[model samples]
Target chain A: MTAVMETAGLGKQYGKRWALHDCSLAIPEGKVVGLVGPNGAGKTTLLQLAAGLLTPTAGTIEVLGGHPGSGPEQLGRVGFVAQDTPAYSRMSVSQHLRMGALLNSHWDDELAFRRIEALDIDPRQRAGSLSGGQRAQLALTLAIAKRPEVLLLDEPVASLDPLARREFLQVLMEVVAEHGVSVVLSSHLVADLERVCDYLVVLVASHIQVADDVAELLATHHRISGPRRDSRSLPADQHVIEESHTDRQTTLLIRTEQPILDPAWTTRPVTLEDIVLAYMGQARDQERARKSGLGVLR
Target chain B: MMRFAWLQFRNQAAVVFGGLAVVAVILAITGPHLVHLYDTTVATCAAHGNCSTATSVFLKNDHTLQILFDALVVVVPGIIGVFWGAPLVARELESGTFRLVWTQSVTRTRWIVLKLGVVGLASIVAAGLLGLMVTWWSSPMDRANASMYTAFDQRDLVPLGYAAFAFVLGVLCGVLIRRTLPAMGTTLVAFVATRLLVNHFVLPKLIAPTQRSFALNGVTVQGFGQMNGGPFTLFPANPNIPNAWFYSTQFVDRAGHPLSTQVLTSACPLLESGPGPSAPAGGGVESAVPAPGAGSALHDCIAKLAATYHEVVAFQPASRYWSFQWCELAIYLGVAVVLAGTCIWWVRRRLS
Candidate 1:
């Protein structure tokens, strides 16, 4: 599939801190991609950079084959629902629809109203008075009604309750099924993305620790339990992701393309959550180790 | 984009235009009565006598309206600056709605331009219309008071100029400050500061004031001195220019130079003042004296001062009223453009 967004050596600096540093990725088209990261791991920063809400301090980024925020064409091609899914609180639902129609060249008014009606949103009611779920839905309706080629949502469901989150995902899934548009939604919750996303990028400590198709990642990574043995003794082909040991035995989550043949080890398939957590844990450890090492050297 | 911008701006425009319409009707009904009163009172009294009392009576007829309109015209620009311009971008940024609007099928430049263009033009027209109405209503009074050069900013075209400058300065303040309440505060401070600075330090110098030198023979001297010892002992030659904005009134020599206080003091010093006590025991009349030849010397110095010292006054002449209006308007419009352009640039470049 053609890439909908591409970034190379992308770095964003906020004062003395690097929010996102030396990041690189190519999000494939026609997929719901999950940009999973912990709080302050630069998920919002990455999304903002792709959405053209930010200028990269270093390197370059392109969304839909043009510089993000280059012009109306690029803007029309990409849709972004920023953190909190912002909508003008004073505006009525109908006014928001009118605004959407007037501002976007590719606006689908029928789709917009139909969705608003389906969601049972009162056209006369102000957005500020709407519930959190309703406001998120209205914001999503606005973004999707633009019929963009790519959608970037920054933690759209982070503030929603379970039922609201599920409903939101259901509506999102329906839109994707209908339009086949590319999507990248960021969240700290792996469970939120697991049900909808086909591709995943795990970010931790300003680093992209992993990026792969969900099924491919699951197929490659495994948890192997065997006799007590140092993690370093594992074969080079078995790349250990996370390891834990007790006095009697050793357990490890590892990634390898080939099937395991060692009778001494019992391997189990890993969940997406486990894979994400393992990567985040590994990145955190590496960062801590590097910091302590530098401290010792100094 | 323009349509969307209008949607966002329509409420403010409605409030402004609607409020103005109501005030306009009131002014319209009462305006003729005021002009007639001015004609019967101040105008007729100008040739007859006691025009000052006539003017006071004329002004008394609609004191409340005049006060309201005066306050409204000045406060209108401040209202625009605080409520409209200051909140234009600050509200969006504060609420994170810029991300939503900016991500739509509109470039950030186009977004900012449309917002500013529609709302800014609306702001100017609202203020301009209010100014026009006030100017028309107050023309008879302004004529009577000879107030064109005195309170120029409170009437006629300059308020519109002030409005334009204030509106743009407000938007710039909003962009720089980023938070709505803080932006509003900053806009008020910046707008007021700009107005005061220009009014006090700039407007007078825009067109060089004309200066005239006249003999001090008829100088009006009033003070506590028996001779020339008190503050006001040396007065400027009276300037004859009517309705002029006087910058300075000073005493200058025949070379057209200012005569120093030292020269006046050295020429004639103070006499010992007044009679002694009037009680029977201590009331033997006063004993005061002058040094030898002091009387002749003071008279000679006074005669020399009358002959040589000349008063020079620099003033913006009354005839330059329209010239000042246009010049100040151009300056304010120029500043408005520059500030608005910077607002656009800041929106596009630094808004993130």
Candidate 2:
């Protein structure tokens, strides 16, 4: 399968601080890939670099088989909905549609108008007066109607009410299914991503903790609790993702492609949320260690 | 891109041209009358004899219009810079809407170019038309004076350059500052400062000024008056070159050596140069030679002592009026191009 978005040692620096660095990964096309991270995990920086809203300070990023923002042709291939889902406040809903048609090479006007009509948006209403949810819907419509090869969204539902968020994801899923567009969406809340995401990328502290298919991740990762024991005693193939212990008891979430043969430990399948949080905790530890001028915890 | 650019500036264009139309109507209606009045009173009277009264009346005809139009010519470019240019990018950046537009099929280069292209062209047209109106209305008065300095910045084709420069300069500031209020303030400060610096320091050096050397002995001496002891030069406007831009007027020894202050101040009568304490407050020019015969006695004494001295002047010729206008226009436009290019580079390379 062809990769829709790929980064090799990608990094971005704002003023002397590197927001993201040493990132390398490839996201396969035709999948809804969720990017989960903490507040300053460089999620926005990563999405912006892929969308060409920002240029990398180091390394390279490619989207749709070309450099991001190489030119208009490259720009046309990717769509982005920035953090706040901004729209021109003075323009009418129809004016935005007109802008999309004028600025995009392959605009899908029928899809845009139909979506607007079904959402109950008044065509003549100025965007400034639209409610928050309506504005997000409008912004999403504009991005979706562009018929991009890859769509990158930065915290697309970060501010919406629960109902609005659900509606946004619903519309998004419908569009993706119809268009077969690859998507990479970022959010701090894994639950928001869990419902719709088929693949997952967990990022923390400017580092990619894990990138894997959600189903594969669920099948291989397990949280096992049993009598206290040294983590080194686990099978060589079962890599320890996270470890916690109390007196006379041991709990560990380990990833193993092999089946668990030891009957002494009860293995429970991992949820996407649990897997992401475990990586996030590890990233936090890595950050603290680096800040104190120490080596990586592993 | 042109269509989108026009859409963004649609309201500003309407407001600007709407204001221009109103001013155009007012100027058209009143302009001819002012020209006729100048011709009838000042021109005719000056031909036969001294026309001080005629001149005064001409200067008084449209006092309010003069103030309004003069202020407009000076302030209009700066207003466009602040209202239109500063807010162009700053508002988008501040509200985070650039993320929406910059991500589109249009490259940042085309986005900035089209905006500057549409609005920049409009700025030139608006300022040009306004310049035409003001220049035409002020032509009669302008012709009556030999020196162009009186209304230089407030008339002619230079406003087009000024408006265009200010607009781009404001845009550059907005691109760098990325905030509406700071960009506006910086643009105003920068525009006004550049205008003043060019007018005072750069204009003289732009083209070499002509030096006019002549003897001071032959001219009529307006009698000097004593006021508290320190001396000063009191002379009428030179009639030989009435319209010259005088850079300096100095007293020099016959061999062209500048006279030392001690000797000059000690020998010559100390004069109350301009409506000073000892002179009649509103006595005007006549006060310099209070009684008729009082002039010759002072003139003869100064002429005999001044035999050792002569006066020299440095000036710009009056014929350079249009040349100066065009020269300044090219300079402003040249600087404007550099500024605009920098803005485009910044948006493409450094904006995010």
The candidate scoring highest on TM-score is: 2
**Which stretches of candidate 1 lie above 4 Å from their native place?**
B44-64, B214-240, B257-306
**Which residue pairs collide in model 2, if any?**
none
Q: Rate the local accuracy (lDDT) of all candidates.
A: 0.84, 0.84
**What are the per-residue Cα lDDT tens digits for candidate 1 across B93-127?**
88999988999889999988888888888888888
Instruction: Point out where model 2 deviates above 4 Å.
Output: A291-298, B46-50, B214-220, B225-229, B232-236, B240-242, B259-293, B305-308
Tell me the lDDT of model 2 at A68.
Answer: 86
**DockQ scores for all predicted structures:** 0.83, 0.82
Model 1: per-residue Cα lDDT at residue B348? 84
Return model 1's CA RMSD, one decimal.
5.3
Per-residue alpha-carbon lDDT of candidate 2 for residues B1-352, written as tens digits (9 for 90 to 100): 7888887799999999999999999999999998998888788985868776677667777879877987898898998899888999988999998999988899889999999989989988998888889989877666665456678788888999999999999999999999999999999999999999999998888888786556655352333443244344334224367567777765577677775545544554432222332222234433333554444444554665577765677777788878888999999999999999999999999876
Candidate 2's DockQ is 0.82
| True C-alpha contacts between chains kept, each model in order | 0.96, 0.81
